[model samples]
Target: MTEYARGLSHEPPLKPERPQFSSGPTVKFPGWSLDKLKTESLGRSHRSAVGKARLKYAIDLTKELLGIPDDYLVGIMPASDTGALEAAMWTMLDPARPATVAAWESFGNVWIQDAVKQLKLPNLQTLSADYGEIPDLSTIPQRNDVVFTWNGTTSGAMIPDTDWLEPGREGITINDATSAIFAMEMDWAKLDATTFSWQKVMGSEAQHGMLILSPKAVERIESYDPPWPLPKLFRMKKGDKLNRGIFEGATINTPSLLATEDYIAALEWAKSIGGRKALFERANTNADLVKNWIEAKPWLRNMVSDPAKRTNTGVCMVFQGDWYESLSDEDKAAVPKKIVKLLEERNVGYDFNGYRDAPPSLRIWCGGTVEAEDIERLLPWIEWAYETVKNG
Candidate 1:
């Protein structure tokens, strides 16, 4: 039995008004209404003029929100973030040059697998770190194309800054920023290729990938031909020239016009709240609320020990009681599942379980869409659930 179980306590008085906090398809913007997308060009061919205009509007809004460089090309691709990343990898990676992959979590590991095993690159250097830590950026060779995830969503670890990247490197840097883009600041000047999905930070629909490429990355596509055969979805170049139309609203395949409108609505919401700075502040404030709660509760500790590396979007935590530590791995896993189930049953929170591949812990979505007051309300329920599970 745990100390919390024995202590005299009453259940928390309030419940969060909204309880949709899955990391992907996160809680929609506060006051989001489906009616807002009524203007969407529904049932229209994506190749039609109106459809093309809507797609272009989404691209322009993304550029405006992120402040992407004028030289960079932004495109909408198939298969969400994975598709954008795979397209970049297949189209830009030079078979002659060595490839370097840095993986600190599941998504990063996927890229590593693509480069090392799938592509079977001749020269490959893999830099890996544990769940809570980032791989050492200094070990990556400047001459080798490097691939890494800016934020490890599953692990709740994020790269603190772009200082680790060499400013004058000969090779390109491919970053998967699906969970990091709008919630955090990125040094765009240092990144050659960046990819994200609408479902992550913006709480929009899935299956659409946003691919951003620097001039250098575009040049790589035009200059170097990959040794592997390119799929239609992965091909970014037509003959020796880069496909310029793709960057200007021409998609490799059909896109969801409704999803495009939702993204536009999300971007408009972002603008209404003062854009990137406001979004970051919301996520940071929610995270700080949880951080303070974690400090007050001795039984809970952050999954990522380093405060600097902690993710503001996905706040992962573990139970720290001696009782919890004494449990077998299977029991430890079962405890979190019970706690999550209890929270859900009580309507206090939802999808608070850690990533399946990660350590048994609670992974809370603290992104812009989640309210700080709600996080404040939800903490007590979590304590109650944990105590109940521990004692039973």
Candidate 2:
């Protein structure tokens, strides 16, 4: 037997009933069944009346579940959350206005790159923080268009509240909230545009994006023509006016009907569990179980130091044992891989490793779909994996 395997005197007594902890393409809602997707309009065109109605239902359900404002327009876009955010940036960010981009993690950094290198905006401000920290939201210019991620999926740091945003400001706030939606409560009144995907909290199939736009955002798109040419897919405007049809169920391209039905089923499950508040509660409860365990276990510490900034969905953690702390950077990186491999071999967890661009750590998805009881079962396995890896 291998040295690491031989070190274990006993196996963990229990395993998580569902072992999917991926930040994206997460576990499906509890009790989800393939039969729920049988009613999908698989052979019909997305522009057909039946297809359009199904798309509209998805948008309406999204707005209702998230408590989006009545004036906000929600649409299904191409690609995933990245496509939704790019569409917002390409369409709504007027060259006349200065741009401010804040980033503390990998996905947030992607937005910063789009503003600087791609758009090549001359008037730009970049606010950045380390992986486990959040940039000062108050420092973002109120008079400029702002782009940021609501939650740092890699870093596990999230904006605590929207109180920092200025009310009645001229700036448009565009947020990539792929990992935050459904799990956290957002102040939609403070945001002009928000983007998410079906794969994150809902555990639906990927390759689809949802863009939520406020009246101000739509007005910006309708009035300002961007200096750079917008690709056909990114174009939100038809002539001088906004493309109202896109917001009303006419997608830019064909969509996966199967994925659509899966999303609908997930939304229905959310409604059955008492909507957004209950979803938030479920995620929070899962996070609490981890937080409490971390408090009791000195070997582990939260990646994000500030408890308030810690996200309930993607829970990143770092090893803090003296031996672990003494290791070289290369060794430290290998350790997490070893631990994660051990867990996977036993089928206690999967995709719990931190993002490639972030610090070496563990990232556990504690979103609404994940049960607290499953997390409770997984914690002991994590402890066991760490011990075996560290000892070997």
Candidate 3:
């Protein structure tokens, strides 16, 4: 057993037989097995014919699942979602033009960091909200480029609706939809560029980023004169034309064929479950299962106080108490530590602790691969854990 698996303790009578509720890289794809890649030419050079074909398969499968537009370009970019976002920022955003970057959590903050600290872009506006709320898009200055994350994973918050996006306004809108891919509807017409990672909901391994560009994004890549130098990997549209070859499996660096096969499997699994509709239903069903239980019990409250913006994928919650509120960061960490340890000890759920930077709250991944039955199974254990730990 791997360290993660070994860490799990065996418990009888109430052994978890269904799916697990993990936030990320924790999906339970159907018939998932690492050994399936044994027939794959994963050992061959990425530049080899088989490797290229694998890369192409990954891209095509993603496009088909997502219903990407014909005119848009899809590429298997380097780095995870982080790298893909950075590449877009470095290559596409023009420092001279006014820019606005809105942040809600870590991922969005990273983009803001790159814009201000790293690239030192000028005429920039940083709009941010603390966890649950979102900045008013109407208040965002016009004639400025925009950057935002589709879902705030840490806060379990998301833009409640997409009607706020105004397409006619000038400047580009770059989105990091890493956890928002199939779980939410993406109006590609409103976004100039978007990025996502495979591990969050696709149940695939990490180390790959998928970048999709609108024609406007392509125009920006082709025409914009960035104030700084563009790295080789960040450069998307090469010399005023969309690099069509990249879409055809010409990755910037070597990609793992095994990972590609895993992604393909995830797509296949996604399709078998009835595409995006089923995907969203699964997420909603799982989240609703947890939310309904939380509502019935007075001991818990959702981290995102607002029900409208509460995310279905990363569902977070906090115990209601002055004791929890009165604790320092160290003491807060201790409570969650105790809670998670008990859960792990019972093999109920592993790694379901709150984010280190965020306030003490349980983070649950309720994506498509995580079943509603599992969420139902998890709630009793959470109650058991609270009782088991608090009594100590």
Candidate 4:
């Protein structure tokens, strides 16, 4: 830090074109504007002909954008990712079967709590790790129900691949893929129930979650009666059979037509840019910009020790070096607090601070909606802020 911190100009770096880097509800797609969203569906009952069609269109576009299997089901749920995941949990997971729930970050921890306390699964095996590290999930039982997150948004760590999943596995696998859907590879075959919200990789409006189910998951729901009572929002079954209307576009409750329009625009944007492949490339390109910047400097480092396990979206970082570590714990905490505050005050960055429960650090969104050039521009601002705060 001392070596590169010297002889630098006091002037601040050029501002990024868009300073939004929030992990969820991230920056919108380039060229996105209010006028661009469709207004025909606004103010209408979501159950009306026009509103239902609009909602279904978003679901169809999602399947097309991600190349989801035709046999699978995709539906819009309320309360964003949390609701979608919980719906799958309450309906699909059976109390009779032993299960494995794995988590390595804050949201993952939420699921662990759901299984242990909320669901009260007596035979659950909980796997977890501290922030910035991934728990080894390589040996989960093939016959044990499993729940895991594809990417830990708070930890900046991701499961690198699906090699751990077996093709002949009997138990269904539920995945929380909010941050990984567009930016990371999703091995659909290994995943039984997958959930995400438009607010993540697509950078659309929030509060609407997408719940996708594989054939195996649907079968489980049909045969298994929920041991616990489900709320109106979590009920996917209409009496004895699965409610197919939800998957076909009739939501349990009203959805924000405005957010639906914004999400549709995002999916359309994704198609124009070469679909899923292009989205992953853009996110990786932005992550690379940050990765290179971190390598070139001595003062900062990626929070994840293994580069392979880090997520392209929500890349987290922490300050390093003897001079910084030598400071008191309170001072270390203040460093990122001050750096983020300075950057935010200058409008050079926004919502890029690390998760509160984790160590004091930085978390930058490198999702497809964010441009690589903006990341390159923002790197210098981070360094400048770090120095400014540490020195003062």
Candidate 5:
């Protein structure tokens, strides 16, 4: 019997549309209930006392949820994780010291482009691996700064631990942990700087970036003299001094209070649900559901070659068999397309299609908002979709 037939079944009076498990802008929690968003209040002046209090409350709640260190500064910056990362990079890098970057995906490559190709930093170096693997950390240059993505969302690959980092390095480590924050464990003691957005596991609206800097990052910002002028948004340190106001609710510009409140609400929800343990359990449960399904079906397997390196949040898998390889280019492409279409037609999932840059692989979201039972129910629908498409 299918798991969906038992307690895993959806509640009666189903919506014409089913739940969503796409990469971003995902479905609300299965039992999440909230009042209408307070968008009207967002247009008012953010400099007002009430606005300031709300912003501060949001920041405080976020810090509590993430268990951030007391010395660290968690500030709201412009854009998403991209802006936060760029701000750190542009403001904190010291041209005098060598810089090393680990390029694993699209976002990592962008920073390397800036440090090496665009900025023309003479000491720039990159240790890159293919889509599914991480380059050897020992290969990174010593006595120089380093950059890496904790979770490569595009490739469904992740570095499971940070133990490889050398202690007492002369330079800093800037990490773009956009998808890894909250979804995975991050050791602040081992990292100098990190950036993330609320859109992923937090399930908040996009556009705002949360940049966290350690005391070491602060010291670098205050002492190092970069070869470029720092933009107001990216200004963490200036003239041998750290900008204290940026950490105290003085964002580069006014942000939507509605979004800020939503972020706070989400963080609060995270706390209420047992914090990191709850979040990690959800990912583990979801991944196990999909993995069990894959093991039962010989025709499909995860695209990530190593099971240990597989991402718990963004799960990617591909079809197997000579039947798949025997087909023409268009025919092979059509297999995943047909599977996606059938699933959509049944309203079981959306945006399960593989990334355009990658081979034919199904990308599913198993983030914080997703419940274990929902994932269990969704697996059968995948099998049904594949069969429906193959038979048709």
Candidate 6:
């Protein structure tokens, strides 16, 4: 049992003001609402001047907040993070060259499937580790094309740094940074193609993917054409030249203007909170709260053993202690389900179950949009639910 939960009070802990904590589509900024979104671009043709300006507003703000280099290009893509990542894999990876893939969790494995199964790159090297651990990045050759995730959305493991990448690497690095962009520090100097969705760190609506391409990645797309067919959405180049229009807000497919407005509003909120520094502080504070809570309890622990590799967002937690360890396999698996049911029943939290492919866990989201007070309020309720479930 936890230290603070030692008392035998039957009353429930106080509820959080906002208990919505899904990893994706997370809780909105502290004061977000429908009325705050700009409606000028709604129902208007995206090609029109005002519509393009509206889209560019979100793009420019993203670049500003991210501190992207001047030479790099940032564009909005058709699908969510999946689409943006797929686009990068298709356009940049030359099947002729050998490729290296590193996977520590669900989303990273998806990129592996894309490389070996879908893209069918003949000479491929795959590096993988268990759910809570990271693979050795140093094993990969410096010049081989590499694909990886900046943060494991499902596994709670994250790469500490990109020192494994050489400064003069010949091969491109494609990164799925959906959960890490705003909350964590990125080494843009070594990253080639980076993709994210607004729904992740900013707590905005989904459906559109944001892509940033380094000059090297752009050159590869412009110079080389892969042997396989390119989907219309994945074709980022027109003839031999880069499709600069897409980078300039001429989307290949029609975009949801309402979603764009929501993204803009969220970016405004982020800027109001003092940009990247504040965002990192919010995620760090919430993650530390969870870490301290876990440390104080005998029955809980972080899935990731190494502190440097643990993620600030999408933190995966495993149950410990004699009772949990003594349970049969089936009964152990049922523990998280019962606890989740109790939490949902009380409206304390929702959608925090670990990914289906992973070991049973309570995957709490400690991203920038999640407030510290709400996390503090929610933790005790989780303790209460666990105690109630275990006692029964």
Best by lDDT: 4
Cα lDDT tens digits for candidate 6, 1-392 = 55534433643557778888889987889899999998988889999999999888888999999999999999999989999999999988887888899999999999999998998888899999999999999999987999999999988888998889989798999999999999998899899999999899899899899999999999999999888898899888888988988888899899999999999988899999999889999999999998888888789889999999999998999999998999998898888888778778878888888888889898889998898898888888778778877887
Clashing pairs in 6: none
- Model 4 lDDT, residue 214, Cα: 95
Residues 1-392, model 3: lDDT tens digits: 11222222422235455535556776657567776553456678877888788888778878888888888888888888887888888878887788989988777887888888998887889988876667776667657888999899888889887676776768888899988888988888888789988888776889898889888888888787677767788776666776777878988877777778888878888888799888999889988887887787676788777899888888888777665667677776687678778777766777778777777788888888886666666776677666555545
- How many Å off is the CA of 325 in candidate 3? 4.2
Q: What's the CA error at residue 365 for candidate 4, in Å?
A: 0.3
Give me the runs in candidate 4 sitting further than 4 Å from their true place.
Answer: 1-9
Task: Write the residue-wise lDDT of candidate 4 on 44-76 in tens digits.
Answer: 999999999999999999999888999999999
TM-score of each model, in listed order: 0.97, 0.97, 0.92, 0.97, 0.90, 0.97
Candidate 2 TM-score to native: 0.97
Error of 5 at 381 (Å): 1.5
The digit string of per-residue lDDT tens for model 5 on 152-186 reads: 87778888777777777777899998877777888
> What clash count goes with each model?
0, 0, 0, 0, 0, 0
lDDT comparing candidate 4 with the true structure: 0.90
lDDT string for model 2 (1-392, tens) is 22323457766778999999899899999999898775747798988888999999999999999999899999999999999999999888866779899999999999999988899888899999998899887877789889989999999999988877889988999999999999988888889899999999999999999999999988888888888988888988888998888888899988998899999999999999899999999999999998888878788899999999999999999888788889999999988899889889888899999999888999999999999899999988887787788777
Q: How high is the CA lDDT of each candidate model?
A: 0.88, 0.89, 0.78, 0.90, 0.76, 0.89
RMSD of each candidate relative to the true structure: 1.9, 2.2, 4.4, 1.6, 3.7, 1.5
Q: Where does candidate 3 stray beyond 4 Å?
A: 1-13, 18-20, 322-329
Model 4 pairs whose backbones collide: none
> Considering lDDT, where higher is better, how would the candidates rank from best to worst?
4, 2, 6, 1, 3, 5
Model 5 regions lying over 4 Å from their true place: 1-18, 33-41
